[model samples]
Target: MKANKLTTAIGEITTQGYTVIDDFLQPAQLKSVKALLARINGQFLGRNNFEGGKTERIYSLLAYDKVIQDIVEDARIMAICEAFLEDNFLLTTSQSICIHPGETPQPWHADDVFYSIPRPRPMVGLSTVIAIDDFSAENGGTEIVPGSHLWSDEKIGGDYREGDNERDSAFAERMASQSIALEMPAGACVVFAGNTLHRGGENKSNGPRQALSNQYCQPWARTIENFFLSVPRELVREMSPKLHSLLGYSVLSPFMGQVSGSHPLKTLEPGYLPPVSRLKPPC
Candidate 1:
């Protein structure tokens, strides 16, 4: 799609808290990204369980993967972030999530849980899930509760009971009320606000469902994954200057700098610093 169309799609995501962009990546580019993910998974197997008897296959530190980094930093994707977040933007996390067939459904939740630190200002972050393969209800596509981003913490907690039974009942009721099943085609993406209520569907089909989850937040927000720590300096140096900056490696020590007092440059072998810092010092 043209850049203008991508911008329009992002505008809708900003207004509605979620928007679907069809064919956001070209066929060749999509293939390359998929291959890169497969290679990473082959080299290093990473798995985690998000639901009972169901596991979420994930490959983090994707900023180290040249192909994956390129896709996230692509003009089309960055344009969306620029339109929504404007000046305060930083890549928080990027991962490829796969739900295998027969996995249990994931309960509805927001990504905000990571930001446990109380803040007076509104959340200024967005989550984008790019469908690498066709997402269908049969293959466990994502399900979302629209407009739930406005729910306060107390209100969100009040909707559920204390026990498992009550929780299940509440989820069922919510699903019955305002849930929308996402059936995104390959090369399309779903962008939602950080507080949007969403969950993974059960993958009933025989094949696995895969998608790339990329998050961008205001530079000040605490990130879920420590990007600078997880990614090696060797890889960071090879990355585009913009990607390096997005990974929080451009400046020496700003306010949010020294996440854990450790920098990627300190860990990796000599040769990671970019020729120039793309990001300005934090204000």
Candidate 2:
């Protein structure tokens, strides 16, 4: 990706709250990712709901999977993130969301609802949704409201009607609120800010609508999921240095004489530090 293209993508995301990049992943790479996911599914076959049975779907983290990790760190995608968030950024989460056909639509919400920690900065995080299959209105694609990320929380809540209503009324209201359906072909990726108002669409197709959502945030922001605890240190060591760093490593220290344990590995090599010196405490 050229610098100008990367700048344009970041600008669109910052201004509109969402931007779609067509063919973000190569066809061969997308095929390989699909194959790897199929293998994972096979290993857990017969397990109906993998996402803790929270909803009528299967969701799993593929952070330790090399293929998925590589996709998350793809140069094109990184360039876009770099343009918006600068060079240093941490990947908060990388998980697969599978919406099985006939499932009810997910309620409109933001991904940051689970994080109880307060953020010191605004617009410090964003999420990228990579389409594993052709996303169409009939296949349960995501819907979003343009520039809604800048709207007040109360106004966003007020957009929804109180009582149960027919699909026509609901759709009309959504349209009236400036909502847009995100229907894109496979291999494309939709990147949006954390504050973006969006929801999953109803899956009316016969098969599942699969997508890989990779979220990245500033080093200081608390992650929705504890990736370090879920993924082991050994797995982190096996990953590329860049991927390891992106997965919550190599962060800055807040306090003097204290080292933040953000990175999985402590020392780069043996004899790098004085033997008599004690390890610095985290701030």
lDDT of 2 at 191: 90
> What is each predicted model's overall lDDT from 0 to 1?
0.68, 0.66
TM-scores, one per candidate:
0.79, 0.78
Candidate 1: the clashing residue pairs are none
Candidate 1 per-residue C-alpha lDDT over 1-283 given as tens digits, one digit per residue, 9 for 90 to 100: 4867877776666555688878677898799877876766533222323533444445454654666777778776687777766454778888887777787667667665566644322447788888887999888888888777776666565332221222567655755478787998888888888777777777899987888888888766666778756776666768776786677654333534553355534434464344345357789
lDDT by residue (tens digit), candidate 2, 1-283? 7778777788888788888989788888789878866766533322322131222222325554667878878887787666656355778778776666775555565555444333322466788888888888777787777787676545554423321222445643663468677899888999988767676667789987778888887666666667667776667667787776676656645421223432334644434354346667779
| 33 Cα displacement, candidate 2 (Å) | 1.3
Candidate 1 C-alpha RMSD relative to the actual structure:
6.6
Show the colliding residue pairs in model 2. Answer: none
Off by over 4 Å in 1: 1-7, 42-53, 86-88, 117-121, 158-166, 251-255, 258-283
Clashes of each: 0, 0
